[model samples]
Target: MPSGRTSARRFRNHVAAMVLAVAATLVSGAPAPVAATGQVAPPATAPSPAPVYPITARIVARYPHDPGAFTEGLLWHDGALFESIGLEGRSEVRHVRLEDGQVLARAVLPADQFGEGLALWENSLVSLTWKTGLAHRWDAKTLKRTGSFRYTGEGWGLASDGKALIQSDGSATLRFRDPKSFAVQRELTVTANGRPVRNLNELEVIDGAIFANVWHRNYLVRIDPANGAVTGLMDLSALATEVAATDPEAVPNGIAWDPAKRRLFVTGKLWPTLFEIALDPAP
Candidate 1:
């Protein structure tokens, strides 16, 4: 099998060229809103010398997790954890017990599709497939295969703002889509302080803020969906150090918020444990 990284790198290079071309063509418009409409352009403000940190995470609790599963998407729905695990031949959608990371129900994807991000809207669990140009919807309760949708580009992460589905394609842009129609409502470019933040993966929406993992980075960025500005940054270098002995593919990738319990959780691809964390001031 060809390396996913090789293909991914090629796609990124292509997207980069496309973005540069688009940026050069646009004469003038709102800078901050360029991402909002999926149009690449430079921001009005000049680039900052360094990225700013506005928020962070502090461990609150820790729970055991299966070290073998390569988790890609994670979210809290009702009383269980809804997860999507990747790898084309090993992809699956699982309903897990939050108390002990136990799988209560699961559905296997076709051996050809690698699962990516997941978003729960009302009764449907929308799961994206990496580079497959398809998304599967399942019955959240029964785990039955419900339907599928078509999308262009790579699917990296997914979340819901309680109103629309937010999707990341390993790009700086996050697209808002109608859950029912899968029509793009709007797109936003995420920027940290002043620079475009790309390689966004595994999205989680909490308190109206969009939290995304900056691929290959050690932190999760808090983004303003309205203007694509990064409001906060939380570094996870400590957690990465703890799991340094694990697989190289194991990186921070999962995020879920228990709004009812007011709890936030994060974990990596093949990590042995999932942690509930509290945000702290970065110093």
Candidate 2:
């Protein structure tokens, strides 16, 4: 059997190959797979869904200036914000004030792992590292490392369904894993307009569907949990692009929903603004 590091490298290579293949297919304009009913089928590629949100969001609050944060995961708990910021040497887990983005507490990771997704489960905080294939568990209060487990592929986004830890690895596939053992329980490929959508990142399990941020895009997709079909898309083009035009790294990545307060918060890599939004249901 290959070592954990070797396995991680192999998974990364496979994902890269898959991405290249997708790009090539799009460029060639080849006919994609069909359902075999003598009708034109949807393209195999997962293109971004058209905006369908009926209600426009009003940004309630914006946190500008935490410009060094390469934000990967964000969650709202109690009255504080729990954020997992990425980039190997600079990765950290922090507790911040929701009102002003003030860092209340923080714990830095080792200088080798680029942190990715995070979630609060039970009484501990769970996090995934992008390249290390490691899932870390930390004390929710102290931010002390309690345990670590290995996973396959590059971890991109993670959320909990109140039972299992749901994860995405920059693929069309979404995986559910046992929180304790980190063993994959089942997987589903996300489809938009009957086509598989890859690069699914920054997830939040809202209501019964999975809301994900498509990397490098200005939209959020709501996917049916049972069938992996995209039900709606929310356009956030206006929020991040204003800054993105000036900053190359201001890519939206973090998403957190406050169920109790009925609010949503989004932020990006090295961005100065954190937006508080209210998602109106699609009509």
Candidate 3:
């Protein structure tokens, strides 16, 4: 009989092997062979589709010189804009005016930690710190540090559904956690057109669907909440090209929706413009 320690080690090794095998299969484009027994064959050995969408997007409004904010997270509540800015020694959470880009209230993070994602739950604001494994909660109205929680992995994106919190790292996985305790409740891998779309970041939950920004790309994907399927894609290539021409470091990384006002907002890292866009399904 195996000892408890040895059994635990073996279990961990098995999990690691499974993860590596999946990664290898994804990268090599080789299908796993099937045996003689009646079993379904593996997927076809083909490269995944490129991370480009063909949907048309029109910018409804754009504001220049919005602090050149290294945007990590964005949210809109009750006619106020909440934004989280990243980079160590320069991280801040600010309440801004939606009409014109003006900081109304702000709270700065410590100098050593880079901010990543944020969400608004109840009356508090929650934010994650990149590489720090720490999540901070603040009083939304006063900007006072209310509490803190710890989580594993690199923080990338966050969203809330008026119940649980949804988060993503740089992987293809989306994790759902309890808001108060910060305990992971469930997880799922995101698939785009039958292929896994990794590097998922900057999340927003709107109308029961998960919308995420694929980091370093000019696309935002609408994911089915139940099975993580890519149902629709929004192409922001024009906005990306324009931002790149003006600022090469600008990368789209924030998304927020105001259901009451029926509006959407998007911005990028170290960007000077925050855009309000109206979404209309293509004919």
Best by TM-score: 2
For residue 59, give model 1's deviation from the true position in Å.
Answer: 0.8
Top-lDDT structure, candidate number: 1
Rank by TM-score, descending? 2, 1, 3
- For candidate 1, report its TM-score: 0.80
Please report, as a residue range, the 10-residue window in candidate 3 with the lowest summed lDDT: 38-47
Candidate 2 residues lying further than 4 Å off, grouped into runs, are 1-44, 48-55
**Better-scoring candidate (TM-score), 1 or 3:** 1
Residue lDDT tens for model 1, 154-203: 88899998899999987778999999988899999887555676678899
Residues 1-283, candidate 3, lDDT per residue (tens digit)?
9998897567545533433443456568554444222222334221133432333355788875374688889999768888888888989998988778789999999999888899999999999988889999999998899999999888989999888889988778899989999999999888855667777789999888888887655667777878887665665665776666355446788898989866789888876677888776532
Query: Candidate 1's error at 66, in angstroms?
Result: 1.2
Query: Considering lDDT, which of the candidate structures 2 and 3 is the better prediction for this target?
Result: 2
Over 176-205, each residue of candidate 2 has an lDDT whose tens digit, in order, gives 999889999999889755668866888998
> Candidate 3 lDDT (Cα, whole model)?
0.77
